[model samples]
Target: MGHRHKNKKLGILIFLVVCVLFLHYCTIHDVVLRHAIYRMLFFLPLVLGSFWFGLKGAIFVSISIIIPYIPYVYHQWNGFYQEFDKFLEAGLFVFMGCLLGYLSEKQQREQEARLKAERLAAIGSAVSQIAHDLKSPLMAIGGFTKQVTRHLSIDHPDRKKLDLVISETFRMEAMVKEMLDFGRPFQLQKTEENLNHLAAECIEISLPFAKSSGVDINTEFDPEITVRPLDSNRMKQVILNLLTNAIQASSSGKIVSVRTKREKQGVALDISDCGCGIKAEDQQKIFEPFFSSKKEGTGLGLAIVKKIVELHGGHIILFSNPEGGVTFSIKLP
Candidate 1:
């Protein structure tokens, strides 16, 4: 897709350059009129560049036009008045490019943002309906399976199978809950709370999972950090999601670390793991809904984490650790 777009741009650029060359070299009895038409024609490429590629592209196209135009202007120079007019025309090309480029870029950004919001809304609605429909049936199945398991002897062959069924049912129920959460709007109940304490609590909650995964979790909390306004429950969800992911990503005996410290903006929380890092291309898409790299992942975990963080007027950043694995950092303001 990118290559196709580039090719189209290149084709248009070549066509525009051809027009300019033809105008410069073509024979004409009316030289003054021809020059006027040639100057006006320059606006086509400038306008296209502004709309197609924004400010830098417009500037680049304007500069490119000037290169071919300089020699023509020198050849057509009649006197001081004509030369000055030509230079003024060139100046206007640049000024127009900048103006059009800025407006075009702003419009493009607004359009993209609107489109994204619409897409997410559609996805959320569909997912909510599906999850709601499945909720009752899933509960019934899990409940009945548990009843069946209770009737079986502890060492019965079917008991183990029923236990697996129950585990899977619980996992599906969690995914459904995630869907509902993503579908609904966030209502933050903010209060002053210590970020360091929050991180510690989340770490403690994740301890069992970390231990099961044979991953050690370490923490560092800065004493200078103070309490800040946050929705404690939602923030805990974010931290726990990230911690769980880190634990899952690490191998046996690997370490996952959580850190909190004072920052100029507010406070920073970091979660790092010693597992295989994400591929470069996939990193940008990780926070996007339903974009997990895991085989059995519902892919809503990080998306929910990002949404909660953003609701608190904070942003999350991700990067690969130099040694191994990925680090997720959240900055609260």
Candidate 2:
């Protein structure tokens, strides 16, 4: 990564220096009378470098051109009336260049962070699946070891040692299964399905858990709305993930709702939770993998939902409500 960044910086600086030379020579006929275009030229390297190759690239461009600017500066030094305007032009050019470059770098950093989160979420999901799959076998191993221990003589130290081995193996196996589940990728197959039907199924499965947590879920959807292409199982997962998250996030006596409608350009699936909304700083990271509000959450649920939505060529947008809740919008194209 460092080498690639260094190479990108080198390439951009070279390109910017070439631009500066071309601009300098192109205006040679008007050398004695400095032109506004030259001031504009001052930003060519900095702006281009910063916007594409980031801050380091822009700094390199700036350093490369700054030395050349000195000769031009000295040439017009004696013109008393023009000094202020000349300095102002230079300052503004440099400031805007650096500012734009910094902003570009910041955006790239944010995007990179999102990608990292998604990868971790994917890992988490694999872990969850593996953990689920291994529970029965691990249980059997532990149970057999326990049964065998009771049959052995109380003085049999070897029996107890075997039980310890069984116990440790189960623990290691559980961790291995979790790692597998979290590392696997999801496969989505879309078919036309009722949005309301999917939501109902998810709610039914999670209803018992939600009730135990003292949360309520409600849904309103068009009964005969035109069916759109969707992956029923995956959509069920998405609904359950979102609804489960909503229920877990909601405080005692809070309610969550699932609603759908035909909106301009696409169909909309909205899930609103009257729970404590996400913190302002965490809103953007909410859909990122391994990022969660719940203490026990693995954080892959929402990340998988986002990936599924995006795979369907849909948009998932979230925001905090003034009512101290959260509104999630998924628009599928």
Candidate 3:
């Protein structure tokens, strides 16, 4: 991950350096190469940067090129309005960069969404079949273990081991449920519900476990937010899974903060925890089923969360800090 990041930074630096050098050369040689077409050549790199790095990259490269070209433009004309016209020309360049960069980003995102939908469609079928096949056997095992425990006295020699077996079976059952949940087609039964109230319910459910581990749970819901149409049950599941993961990630006395806010685009829910943060490489794989960092983790929690968010025409963003903590923000429209 470090190597990849370093390489990306190097590439951006090299691009900016080359662009700056070209602009400087043009400025110094303006007498021989000062055609209007020559001044407009800067847009080539600006467009390329946007396609390569997105809006901010395009704007940054535009500003870098404009700085060198400004002095040349100033030396060409002495009138006050002429200087203002040059600034307007520079502003046009900036606007072009922003527009092209935004379109390129939007296109890239659409392509990614198409690819993700295809992948999910392929995987969901196989997972559904597998979960269906495994469910019956797991239920049988759980039933047998419970019956055995009922027969055995609490002081029986095998009682503790049998109890452990029952617990393990229950855990397996939960995993199976998650598999089915992720594999099946989800249809949101939307109704008007307050996001803050849903969050409070999730917090209430997770509070006991948090307190047991000496972790603190905090909430900050926007007072101005009102009831909005959403899938109450599924949204609640998303909140609970996030809260549970945060609680599990933190150590004693660490704080987990959950917040909901109204944004111009939609509603946003942020779940953050001061815990042992995720590694850079692992962060990308966290949403892949069965890719877990924990000894007994199912790794389906976040995957399910992501699927649900996407189903609702929303997106999830992960901000991971290895030294500090991680935050998962879900935006629902």
Q: In candidate 2, which residue ranges exceed 4 Å CA deviation?
A: 1-33, 36-40, 43-181
Cα error, candidate 2, residue 291 (Å)? 2.2
lDDT of 2 at 178: 33
TM-score of each: 0.88, 0.58, 0.70
Query: Worst 10-residue stretch by lDDT in candidate 1?
Result: 21-30
**Model 3: C-alpha RMSD to truth?**
5.3
Could you report the Cα RMSD, in angstroms, for every candidate shown? 2.8, 10.1, 5.3
The residue ranges of model 3 lying beyond 4 angstroms of the native Cα positions read 1-112, 321-323
Judged by lDDT relative to the true structure, which candidate is superior, 1 or 2? 1
Range of the 10 consecutive residues with the lowest summed lDDT in candidate 2:
174-183
Worst window of 10 by summed lDDT in candidate 3: 28-37
1-333, model 3: which lDDT tens digit per residue?
Answer: 288974686476457546655755556544644645555767777877788768976777877776766666556666877468657877898898898889988999999989988987788778778889999998999899889899988899999998898898888888889989988988899999988999999899999999999999988999887887889999999999989888988999899999999999988999999987888899899888767888875677788988888888899988975568899999988
Instruction: Summarize candidate 2's per-residue lDDT along 105-214 as a digit string, tens digits.
Output: 89999999898777666666666676777777777777788778888897887886977878796666645543453466667788988777787788889989989999
Model 1 lDDT per residue over 31-111, tens place:
778767777887888888888888977988888888776676677668987578667877888999999999999999999
Of 1 and 3, the candidate ranking higher by TM-score: 1
